[model samples]
Target: MELINQTRASLIDYVCAQIATFFPDGADTKAAITRNFAEAMGRVEKCFGAIRPWPAGKFNYLQSAQYCLFLYYLANTIWRNDDDSGTATRLFLLNKTLNGIDLFYEIQMPDIFVLGHSSGIVLAKATYGNYLVLHQHCTVGRNYEVAPVLGEGVVMYPGSSVIGRCRVGDHSVISIGTQVVNRDTPGNCTIYQGDGGELAVRPAGRNLIEEIFRV
Candidate 1:
């Protein structure tokens, strides 16, 4: 993949600088970053290449959404491969500080996903699937320690939420501003808040995931 305005060494330095600036604790990040940087970028490439909105095989560090995903992959790579919790924590904090997104590094995200806007988005530790797309002010969180399980090709629009023991089926579209709490949806459905604030479901009519991803 083409890394716009970043070579491997430059990107590593950039991340280390961000961590140091945000944390200012004098912790060593170079070793952990060096150990896991390539794997992390590989994951980023795979994800970015799959998304249709993003130009395939190219990564732009100036883009907030792409940078957010990069930070997540970097943190996750270090955590999983090097068992470097301190560095991983710093990366997570840096991402939150810069992007206003609360995506913990430990959360097991799928290999291919898209974030329309990272601001005001919170993704909890839950079962996720490939080709998931999340927009601004969207949330997939837990209720009383119970999180929602999302299937393949799920799309959560802006201001939409799926909280607490919800089973969102494959190709399901959670409409804008809809709140799905403690409910289940069938595959290929669109979830919305009906009249009187009740949950409603209807066929999505089109495959949004197919359009967004190179599936």
Candidate 2:
């Protein structure tokens, strides 16, 4: 499913990714994280779109054809990382085309993403829905503790880890430098690590107006 304010989210996500690359604790710099993500993603999309092979101004961003082209670009990154076969690659496109994305652990797939300098990587019985993002050195493995079911638009930050059987809801943002194990999280919530493997959730309907950083 497409996220609410997907463009904004995508943009912010990209920026956050960049900062994370440079700074281990970038997410703590909330304002920089927010600003960079939006700008970087927007530029990549715009620049890439301009360079794509379009005939005589026929490339309309709203059109299905154009959208697929962009998705293909993004999907290619994952494909290359997993060393996926052509057939597997096509299947990914098909899934992305039909369902936006469905990289669940149980789903038939060959190419899984692994970022560089990212080790200790693992995932089992996890359903990685579409637009899934992973930064360097994150892990998704199961413990006798919990198995994870990742929803669409799920992101894992560097040094952040998850293990056990739990569900991470759609459009959920996993905070950088956070580690989660056997935690059930709500949709569209910003995730943070607290003491004892617990998470701090900022739910949508909940007010952030007071800067009520719950401990």
Candidate 3:
């Protein structure tokens, strides 16, 4: 999706302000922090182009919260180096308390992914695809040492999980309340819990990311 350029600078400045809050006494760190913030904002702008106005307007409260949470994590994980552990921890805890986004547990962001909501979501250090949308109450975790590998354009609806060493194909949707463990899902399909709690798959209705955002 093409981003609206008018709000980009404001958004970057806001993110830099947030990073500054964690290092009030570190004037020496300002230059490095600002540089990292710029890099993080680039990734955030690419991933969350759908949410306008940076923190978003009043009517888009959920989107605003989600964007903030994403920024917090991205700033620490994707941009800042390991030398900034103290500041990164502070930002991580703040995000967890404010947005209930538990990304501290080995979660890493994809180059471009969207969060539908910021509550009850758990992500591990798995291979996430671009244009992924994660709704509320979703989990993408590992089983022992094995992690799930998701293809591009995947969507996980509320209460859905893709666990273990499963491979989910591109354009696949994990329907609400579905749990996929140690299985492989094909591309352009939807998976749901069927009778007796069995996981089922069918052709996906449409390309949501393409249809909605034309990304």
Most lDDT-accurate candidate: 1
Residue 160 CA error for candidate 2 (Å)? Answer: 1.4
What is the per-residue lDDT of model 1 for residues 1-215, given as tens digits with 9 covering 90 to 100? 78898898998999999888889999999999998988998999999999998898999999999999999999999999988999999999999999999999999999999998899999999899999999999999899999999999999999999999999999999999999999899979898899987988888878888889999
- Per-prediction TM-score: 0.97, 0.42, 0.76
How much is the lDDT of residue 178 in candidate 2? Answer: 82
lDDT of 3 by residue, 1-215 (tens): 22244254454455456556754655343444455654665555555564332332221213545455555645465334545655455556656656666676235666666667768887888898877888888998889999999998899999999999899999999999999999989889999898886778898897787753436
Residue 100: error of model 1 in Å? 0.7
TM-score-superior candidate, 1 or 2 = 1
What TM value does model 1 have?
A: 0.97
Worst 10 residues of 3 by lDDT: 52-61
Clashes in model 1: which pairs?
Answer: none
Identify the superior model by lDDT, candidate 2 or candidate 3. Answer: 3
lDDT of 3: 0.68
For model 2, the stretches where C-alpha displacement exceeds 4 angstroms are: 1-120, 203-215
Best by TM-score: 1
What Cα-based lDDT does every candidate model obtain? 0.93, 0.49, 0.68
Compared with the true structure, model 2 gives a TM-score of 0.42
| CA RMSD of each candidate after superposition | 0.9, 16.0, 4.8
lDDT at 130 for candidate 2?
50
